[model samples]
Target: MADAAALPSEALTPPGGGPGAGPGPGRAEGAEGLFVVLGAGLAAASHPLLYVKLLVQVGHEPLPPTIGRNVLGKKVLYLPGFFTYARHIVKVDGKRGLFRGLTPRLISSTLSTVTRGNVKKAFPLEDMEHVSNKDDMKTSLRKVVKETSHEMMMQCVSRVVSHPLHAYVSVLLVISMRCMVQFIGREVKYSGVFSAIVRIFKEEGILGFFVGVVPHIVGDVIFLWCCNLLAHFINTYAVDDNFSQASVIRSYTKFVMGIAMSMLTYPFLLVGDLMAVNNCGLRAGLPPYAPVFTSWIHCWRYLSAQGQLFRGSSLVFRRAPMQAACFPID
Candidate 1:
């Protein structure tokens, strides 16, 4: 009877009983917990939008008209732009074509989200509570700036930690069947994910894995900061402070806010995507379409030279409405 009573007390007591050693740190607490979080995140990150967005961005490059003879020997000119590329994807690979690079994207993005969340919790910045209704415009702007800065810091930290996965994601995005055929030509094809991975490893070695990290990190920071600021603005200015249990208004506000955020940040996303898959031809064992830009500045410079830096901005804006709603819906 005494041992049973003591057992309850012991279970409730801290390990040190002094202060710090209560429960273990929750950040990736154990191998099981780590695996579970990563597994769940991996599944969640395999969203169709991942592939769609990448494809849309990659298809921004204008393809030359392919001249061929029809059944009657008539001249047929096929030009591959965004829509044509999308059609080719569907015609060639069917529905499954839309899911190219899902595996590596799932892994990279899941790890990024998890790591960012952990880093955010561990190294919190200025509390949002300080920004109040009574604050002046300048004060409010300052608060938003702080919030954006905090988000960027957290994202950068996570990006570095997940750099290898990020590089793999970039490589996969570039060499995925849809990208390989549409962006390059049908001549170069990856057998599947495994073959693509091995091919990258052998061809470029370790540094190859870090191929597009710089652009990705830069784009991620800018997008996150802008999105968070916009969301904060909407939440503060647009949303009602008091709400009942089943608040349709709040839900709608969130949905609209998300869509607006997606649209606003898309240009930066275009730059990132361009830099990311910039090496697609090289990765496919063909001559690279453009010289490898060593940094974000170089990438931007190259794009600016071609006058196509904002090539996919319209497509991204058009897709933002559906893409953004997925966030709040999920």
Candidate 2:
């Protein structure tokens, strides 16, 4: 999957690619980036399990009161509850509704991934061969610093470039859903990615496009740093020096690390979604209400007041395994 996403950037890479090349290569690279992005979008949109995962994450489970019962205290007669949420989704919005916001998510994630990949490829790091010496801890520390620097740089570039799409994905996946109306005091009737783009832009302007971006960027850098450092620790102390044994240990560690990282960073993700949802407007002619937060700190205070810093964490736990599975793919 990473290879497919990187194909365009690699194709556009100048012959004998080297660090600090001229900006001319960057233009070709940008255009080529679109192909990989489209491919990523399709892949993300078509994944079967992702559909169910997304629905669950967006508060689609357990049936809302509107669909669960009627005013007379009798079972609300509705479609067969066999595939409860799936049936509800079809009944309410048709089959195509299951794919809501797929385009925005695809664009956001693909751009983020492609941008990071291009940056990493364009500025290849010097091989850390010197870090192999066991006699010096300085070499190990240097290696960690080098890897973290590259990763931080990639993440910063990717997050900035992808902020709009990321915001769109969050809004589409969770914000646009009426489930959040109780918290946000607004009902966003999702009309697909294009409609969302226009509405958010018109209502909230540039700032709306970046709600929760600070936490997202900060959490991303922390997650990457932790993952790299954990891998180094595992490689150094836990795993034996045997090549095959070390390889197996490394693989397992990475999977475990991915889930751990996801769990740790989930609060930031939750906060970001909340901020975005709160900022977006749904009803027309409302003159666009003020956003709930002026900054991530303000958002944190609001969530703290509500005691929902870890709201809907069960979905994140359910989602972690998939995150771990995709670790290598990214």
Candidate 3:
């Protein structure tokens, strides 16, 4: 029952406290991996729900100032759907229910926005109007392609880097506030914005902030390379009608991109999630409770007949060759 830390390098001592131990490590390390994969599927697959929620919140919810604003100056908002549902549920359950995963979502949202913004600036793939002004179709097209690729890569890396935070936060949103409190006990109350910041700094130190960063960078970078760029590309070439479907097309594009992004970067997200869970998300945070498979099954159950959500995902790549001239969606 010796302390594993004190034990010899090669020895495998008793876990938490056999005779002379403290805490034990079991499947804790592997837990986040499951969340990452599960999280991506949940986000990617149920995108319509997310969009619908956002639409409702922007129309009829009490949230931070960023709802319909093009730029959320200092918003403290949740994802559109989760927040909407949460607000309704909280009306019945109280404040605890409405803001369950506030911390991780805040962190992840900031990171995603920053990542997307920077990548947009760096690549500006969607700004083909400026880049293509030279009137040289061949040159303009090549430039667009390169810029799009670059944007995708940047977005992918950013998403990967931010995956654990996203996954942790999403799980927090899924579980009820009462359940979270039951599981986390005293720590939950102490984990507000100020407390979480100080705790992470003290416990993880500077090195801790970068937890799961590498794997996420890899995963998200690839995610952007595929899906996000597809959005930018769709904007650039395909389905260029100035009508109602334009918005629909964009939404559908984001959905497809979300799936592609999720599929390609899932393993990386899984690795990152595993790291976050092991670091004390279960007791100290909102994730680490839900199993990976269960979440996917949950997503599919609700994803049956959403109409336009999954409409163009399969044809996302196919749009490329035809992109020289867009085909009518109607």
Candidate 4:
């Protein structure tokens, strides 16, 4: 009786507690707790309008590490997995398929100018030309535009160079997610998160990766457009020197902005999610002249499910690292 009682007490007490033990269960639980907190916290901290709002109002201690990464324009996650999936678009879909979303990429790049691109820094030096006219506005404008173009070029180069691995993981993960979710109601129980990864390795061999590319391209292009457009509009219109910088207000506003963006562009992401399953990568995933409503609704349901599964850069087995400072209002 005493031994049984001790088992329950010890379980409640945490893993490595008896006065002599170091951290075992306690540490594991703490780590998981920390991860959950960080996940939510990182999302908020990297959120600019929120960060600005907090700064203006509460005088918070400081932003989280993710926020710092955002300001510095460095992506925190490696997501070594998804990049592998990128190759499938190249290998199976051919050259055009590999770069399927070029138009969206261009659109994303142009919209990016509003926030991170700051191409305005060049063209409209009228706002701050008095501070330093040592450089001509045209020169400044040229440089900024050139830099923005260069950034886009750099991304393309990187994608091309790392095409193989990126294709592999990305393709596999996308298909795997759709499959697992469909398999959700069955006895296999969708294999949980960490194990889903391991199971991918065991079951699909090295080839499970190509399946994820189409979904990734779809999700990313739409996500970029939505996120960038709203952020751009907010900065261009809503944000200004006076009231726009409030941290709490900005934080909440950013959250809402992200949500609005999500809702608006979610269907595209949904289509991407569904199309990811058919990723032999041989053809463009979308069919020509398909019934608009059927495709859209189909995309929406799948996307909604996936969104619930991987909310805000959060994914189960694979993840997209928080991108560069996406929406910096004012």
Candidate 5:
């Protein structure tokens, strides 16, 4: 998923007044800290949903599908929704279990945020000028293109620098032994984070830490370019400056556009997550549950063929796949 905090919608300017001055150094630092804290808090709060989503993505459906009605009021077999799936997790491992693998995720988010900020500071945009809608259409368009290009460049550089941390987190939380312990039937191997890291290194070596990074970076780049370009065009051409709620409308536009673009790029994320876990020693990554993918391309092709690219995109109102539904429920 795209990190809203790291988006280049607004440039980070140094303290004091300029054409479009940003917050001062101390204030900026404090704000970044608050962002990290709030981000971590949100991650902790939403961990359960993500936990269930990951399991579902890996085809680890411990609970059977239940009868439910769709939005159309048609009767259908629905896989366990968030509450049902979460309740099962609580039953098996208590409330604390819902937070499994959260530590690495939090750390990852914080590191990414900090690293991006520092990198941006190190390579600040030169002659940073705010593009005004008041300017002539051709001039505004030119400025927007220039600014957007700079922003995308900065985003790519920051992403490359910070991606190792992201990869590490994916290793620990997506397909690693640490995350597998959250599943009910998986055998407990490594007891904690440090031990799990050591074991992965011993078995899979350094490459193990970077399993799903390529697709992830690609997804982020695609998302950033699409979302940023579209938002700039809308805000520049579509939204009128004289409108009273112009800012509000533009904000909503960016949010909604980001979501739409995310859906389009979601398959990249799905493939990345699957590759991270594939053939990684857990049953979830092994045969019957999943095939031994030679590379992310193979995984992508398999998922595309199975029409399971968006397997865990929705948490609530999940419908079982036809093949899964055909199997006799225990």
Candidate 6:
């Protein structure tokens, strides 16, 4: 997912203008609208992978494990990969099933982007051109810290504002009659968004809409800091001075760094999503799949003990534990 909260400072600055020249209201609104559309499109395209991944995360293994050779050439149980899981979903719910829960995901993406843009306008970061221009180590470090801090604050505020929508998406993904229940067995089925919202409010109360928000925010913060700091250091010190002239390469460095940081911080995201649906009445969230957790921390500890903190992270080459061993082949 795009880090809507961490929109580049240059994006907020108007073309042919400096940091002092704020983006024109019309231009800013247009840019945000464009991003909303783009985000929705991206979410739609990626929904299948996310759907299958979420089911995997919740321990809903419909397909039996198959025996495969590990990297070490030992017989090991390999869980269904992304394509296998997706094909199974199609078999059950048809092609349209892959897009289940997309409505709320699009809404969440839009709200997050708009909220971040508005919050950024209200609390614009100070321009660091002077600090950034200086090649001194201390100045570069200071600039990075300032930039990361601004990003962290914006992300946290936006997350808090739009988190209820995220919770809604999680519930929808896990309880929709046409989606989640198709994998984990029919338990509780929500008809539509409004009905689901009312039921969640009644069953889980107001707190239901904010479940697992803390860890999500923390993960974002950590990703921002790590990605920004490392990118800054690499661009400033590690790369050749001439490398800065390659604007295209320089631009991609941050994206690559972000991906790396995301992998490192993915466990937090997994825990956050797990906690959002845990004990929320879906069979996937209840006993036999997962135990009731006292807190997100407890959820984290439980998954850690089971070595499942990274479950569903990989779409392919998923090696299951020996305890789950099945269908061994010579």
Looking at candidate 3, what is the lDDT of residue 158?
Answer: 58
Task: Return the top candidate by lDDT.
Answer: 6
Lowest-scoring 10 consecutive residues by lDDT in candidate 6? 4-13
TM-score of each: 0.56, 0.64, 0.40, 0.31, 0.83, 0.85
lDDT of 5: 0.65
Window of ten residues with lowest summed lDDT in model 5: 11-20
- Candidate 2, residues 29-109, lDDT tens digits: the string is 664465465557565655323444333333333343222344665533232232544556566667775655566656666
Q: After superposition, how far is residue 302 of candidate 4 from its true place, in Å?
A: 12
| lDDT for each residue of candidate 3 in 1-330, tens digit (9 for 90 to 100) | 111111111112121211212233334324433434444454444433332232231122233322222244432222233544455555655755444544555455445545544554455444334222234546655765676566556555555554434433222221111123322333453245444445555665644445544554565555545554565566556755566576556546645555545644454543443344333344423333323322322322323332212321221111112232243322
Taking all chains together, the TM-score of candidate 5 against the true structure is 0.83
- After TM-score superposition, the amount by which residue 188's alpha carbon in candidate 4 deviates from its true location, in angstroms, is 5.4
* Candidate order (lDDT): 6, 5, 2, 1, 3, 4
Q: Measured by C-alpha RMSD in angstroms, how accurate is candidate 5?
A: 4.6
Higher-ranked by TM-score: 1 or 4 = 1
- Give the better candidate number (1 or 4) by lDDT: 1
Which is the winner by lDDT between candidate 2 and candidate 3?
Answer: 2
Counting only residues 3 or more apart in sequence or on different chains, how many pairs clash (N, Cα, C under 3 Å) in candidate 6?
0
lDDT values, one for every candidate? 0.49, 0.52, 0.39, 0.32, 0.65, 0.69
Candidate 3 minimal-lDDT segment of 10 residues: 1-10
**After superposition, candidate 3 runs with Cα above 4 Å error:** 1-95, 107-115, 118-126, 129-141, 152-186, 228-257, 281-330
Q: Mind giving the per-residue lDDT tens digits that candidate 4 earns over 246-315?
A: 4334334434554555554433433433333332222222222111223334545644553432222221
* Cα-based lDDT at residue 293, candidate 2: 61
Sort order, TM-score high to low: 6, 5, 2, 1, 3, 4
Clashing pairs in 5: none
Measured on C-alpha atoms, candidate 2 has an lDDT of: 0.52
